[model samples]
Target: MNTPLNLAALVLALSAALTSAPALAHGEAHAGAQAQEVVKEQKPWGIAGDADQVDRTIEVSMTDQMRFIPDRIEVKLGETIRFVHRNQGRVLHEFVLGTKQDLDEHAAMMVKFPGMEHDEPYMAHVGPGKREEIVWTFNRAGEFDFACLIAGHYQAGMVGKISVSPTN
Candidate 1:
């Protein structure tokens, strides 16, 4: 017979199944035991860019102080940019691009699930003294955010801004 407890358990099971796969894959990748392919999905800010279409290259630094050097960046809509990430700290850092709300939600998830992992075209997981890159095409004209959502990093203020202006 159907009951409230069963419904609650069903909801909980569904949520865990939907969310845990990516986190599990991320954990494996984080441990350097496997490689996860870049997930391709169109986002409000833009989509995964073709390396051959990159119009510019921007270098960003992730420091131990929870800061991204040159925290603000401006780009023209429709331009493809190759962002090079340099991790200068002794710990691991991430560069995740998304809307402010999306980032805030993800940050909260990170706080609750410290091992949460996600790999996409707009994110880069960089280890200390390591270098990584994200090629993105800013097809939308608006403001977006990039942050390091690793447990206390986001709460400690590890974030940056990207302003995309219309091309016309």
Candidate 2:
């Protein structure tokens, strides 16, 4: 009698344990699905890059109010960037990538050009509703600043930061 009772108790415990396994797995699967949905929604405005690619592309649009839609950018060291800049502003605009010191130096040089130097590879003075593009590579990891060289533009918060991380 004692032996039969002990066997029955063991069987019951094993069955309960087996039933709970599926429930735990189902809960994990549900959580994973929710995380995937969030990633898909935020991907368009997010910075994406491939370490193996020769050039990574970033699209930036400028408005008359002096703002970049995505004000921050991220990249890995040794990655090349292809920047597509569009001017949706009433006045001219530019997208220049360099250090704070480099921007200051170049900004001074821009004054030498009459009105604004609208035609340069690293600089652009695109008029309203116009678009321009530039490709550059980052050989090292550091904080880089980008801005419009037009007078009073940088002072009006037309600046942004780029973060580069160490390559894997």
Tell me, by TM-score, which candidate is best.
1
RMSD of each: 8.6, 21.7
Worst 10 residues of 2 by lDDT: 37-46
For 22-97, candidate 1 gives per-residue lDDT tens digits of 3444423433322545556889999988889999999999999999997999999999999999999999898989
Clashes of 1: 0
Residue 72 in model 1: lDDT: 99
Candidate 2 per-residue C-alpha lDDT over 1-168 given as tens digits, one digit per residue, 9 for 90 to 100: 699999999999999998875432211232223223212111111232233454667889998788886779998876777777877777777787767887888677655653531332344445677776555566667788888767667768888888988888
Most lDDT-accurate candidate: 1
Instruction: Report clashes for each candidate as comma-separated counts.
Output: 0, 0
Clashing pairs in 1: none
Instruction: In model 2, state the lDDT of residue 43.
Output: 18
Worst ten in a row by lDDT for model 1: 25-34
